[model samples]
Target: MSATIHRIGGREPSLEPMLSLVAPDLNLVNAVILDRMNSDIPLIPELAGHLIAGGGKRMRPMLTLASARLLEYSGTRHHKLAAAVEFIHTATLLHDDVVDSSDLRRGRRTANIIWGNPASVLVGDFLFSRSFELMVEDGSLKVLKILSGASATIAEGEVNQLTAVRRIDLSEERYLDIIDAKTATLFAAACKIAAVVAERGEREESALDAYGRNLGIAFQLVDDAIDYISTAEAMGKDAGDDFREGKMTLPVILAYARGSEGDRAFWKEAVAGRRVADEDFAEAVRLVQASRAVEDTLARARHYGQRAIDALGGFAPGGAKDAMVEAVEFAVARAY
Candidate 1:
C-alpha cells in the first residue's frame, strides 16, 4: 500500500482515536494498576506512584485493550493482564532511568532522581514481581510464557544496549536487534495475548504480534529521531539526552556512515564522551540534517509503520481497525 493513502488531507495523525476506543476498558485496567501497586511499605507506593501516576501514554497496556476489542473479546480477563503489562512497562522505565542516570521523564523528576537509585531499582523489582503475580492469577500457561519471556528479553535488550553504548562502530543491524528485544517484545506480547484470551487461532495472534512489533520499532525510531530535533517541552525529556549518553541510535549510525572524514571524527569524539556541549549538540544536529539522517530515519519509521498497518489487513474493517491504523500513523507522524 502507498504511504500517502494513510494520510488524510495532509492533516496530522493523533492517538486520540485509539485512546477513545480503549478509554472505557482502560479505566478498569487503571483501577487494577492502582490496586496492585499498593503495599505495606510506604516508600514502595510513594516511589512507584511517583512514576506510575506521572503522565504517561500507557501505550503498552492500551495495545492490550485495543487488541482485545479488535478480537471482540467480551470477557474482562484482559483487564488484569493489561494492568500487568503496564506494571512491566513501568518497572522497566524506573530501572531504565536508574541505568541511564536520567533525571527527567514526562517533563518531571525521574523516580531515580527523587528517590535515589537504590529505591528506584527496588521499586522496579517490586513492580516486576507484581506483574508476575498478576500473570499467575490469570492461570494461562501460554499467557504466562509470553509475558515472562518478554520480560527476560527486555532485560537482555538492556544489557545488549549497555554494551553497545559509546561504540562508534555499532551497526544498524545490531541496534535494530537491541530495540527489537528491548522495546518491541512487550508490544508484541501485549497484542498477542488478546488473541489468546479471545481463543483466536495462531493466525490472528501472529498478525497482532506483527502489528505491534512493527509499530514499536517505528515508535522507537521516531523517538530516536526526535531526541536530536525536538525540545524538552515537546519530548517530555531532555532533547540531547541520547547524544550526551552516547547512544548509538539509527540517526547517529546513519550520519556517521554517510559523513565526511572530519564529520566522522566529530562523531567519534561525540560518541566517545569527548564532545558534549550545547555547541556540540548544535553541530551534531547540523551534521545529521546535512546527511539527511533524521529524514531517512523517519523514512525508515514510515516503512515499519506501513507494515504495522498492513498487518491488520486480515481483520475486518471497523472502528477498532481504523483506530489501530491511525495509531500507526500517529506513531510515524510524531517527529513531523
Candidate 2:
C-alpha cells in the first residue's frame, strides 16, 4: 500500500508547538537507540535500522518524554528509558508479524515477510536483549521491575489471543483482558517508569499510569474498529486479515452478540473452519454493520479516551497536557 499520513479527526495541531515540546528529548533518545543498535554484525544492524527509521508516529517515546516533563522530571535518564520503551515496542511488532503471518505493516512489507520468519524472530530477540541492555545501563531496580512485568504480561496476552482465535465463546471480558495485557500494560509502564525516574511518589504517578493504560485500550479498540471497515488500500494490509486469520476482534464479538441465529452459524462455519470466502467477507461486513459493532467500538473508545483525559486531573492544564488530552479525543473521534 502507498504510504500516507492519517490526520485523525481534528484541525491538526501545528507540528511546531508539539515538536518543540518533544523534539529535544525525542532526538536524544532516538540517537541513543540508533547508536546502541549499531553492531559488528552488518546485516542485522542495517535491517534493524531500516525498520526503526521507517516512519512510525513514535507515540510511545513521545508519551514517555512528555509525561516526564509534565511532572518536572529533570533527569536525563528519561532519554534512555524512552529508548528502551521504543525497543520493546519494536520487538513486539516484529514478533507480532511473525505470529500473525502478516504481510504489511506501517504501509510497507512486514519485517517477517521481507526478511523471512526465522530472521525476523531472531532479530526481534536481539532487540529484546538490546532493550534489556539499555535498562541495565540505567541501574534502577524499579525500572527493571516494571519493564520485566510488562514483558511477561505482553507474552501472556499473546498466548491468550492465540487460544481465543476461532473460539465462538470468546467474551467481551476476555477480549478486553487480552488488549490490556498485550497493549495497555507496556503503555502504562512507559508512563509509570517515567514517574519512577523522576522520584515522583505522589498519587499522580498512578494517574499517569492510568492515562497510558486507558489510551492504549482506546487505541487498540480503534484499531479493531478500523480493521473490518477499512479497505486494504487505506489500511496498508488486507482488509479482512483478521477474518482470514480467524481472529475474533471487537467487531466480530459485537456482531456475534447481535447476530441472528443464521448469521451466527454462518460466522462459526466461516471463521472456525478457517474457510472464509469472498462471500464470508461480505457477510462479516453485513453482520458487523447490522450489529452496530463499529459504532459500539467507537462508543467504547470514547469512554476510555475520556477516562484517559480524566486521569490528568492534577496536572496543571496547559498546552502540552491539553494536547495530550486532546490527542485522546482525536484518536477516539477518528471512529467517525
Q: Which candidate is the best by TM-score?
A: 1
Query: Which portions of model 1 show Cα errors greater than 4 Å?
Result: 1-5, 8-10
Q: Give the per-residue lDDT digits (tens) of candidate 2, residues 1-336.
A: 111223434466333444568888999999999988888888677668767887777778888888887887788998988898988988898899999999887778888777799988888889889989989989999899988899889989999999998898899999999999999998888888888888888686798899999989998998899887888866777788888888888899989888889988888886786558877788888889888898888788877877887798888977678667766765665555
Q: In model 2, where do residues sit more than 4 Å from their true spots?
A: 1-18
On the 0 to 100 scale, the lDDT of residue 221 in model 2 is 95
What digit string (tens of lDDT, one per residue) describes model 1 on residues 1-336?
A: 135427755778888989999999999999999999999999999998988889898899999999999999999999999999999999999999999999899999998888899999999999999999999999999999999999999999999999999999999999999999999899999999999999999999999999999999999999999998999999989889999999999999999999999999999999999999999999999999999999889888988999988899999989899889988998888897
Candidate 2: the clashing residue pairs are: none
Provide the lDDT at 96 for model 2.
90
| TM-score of each predicted structure versus truth | 0.98, 0.93
lDDT of each: 0.93, 0.83
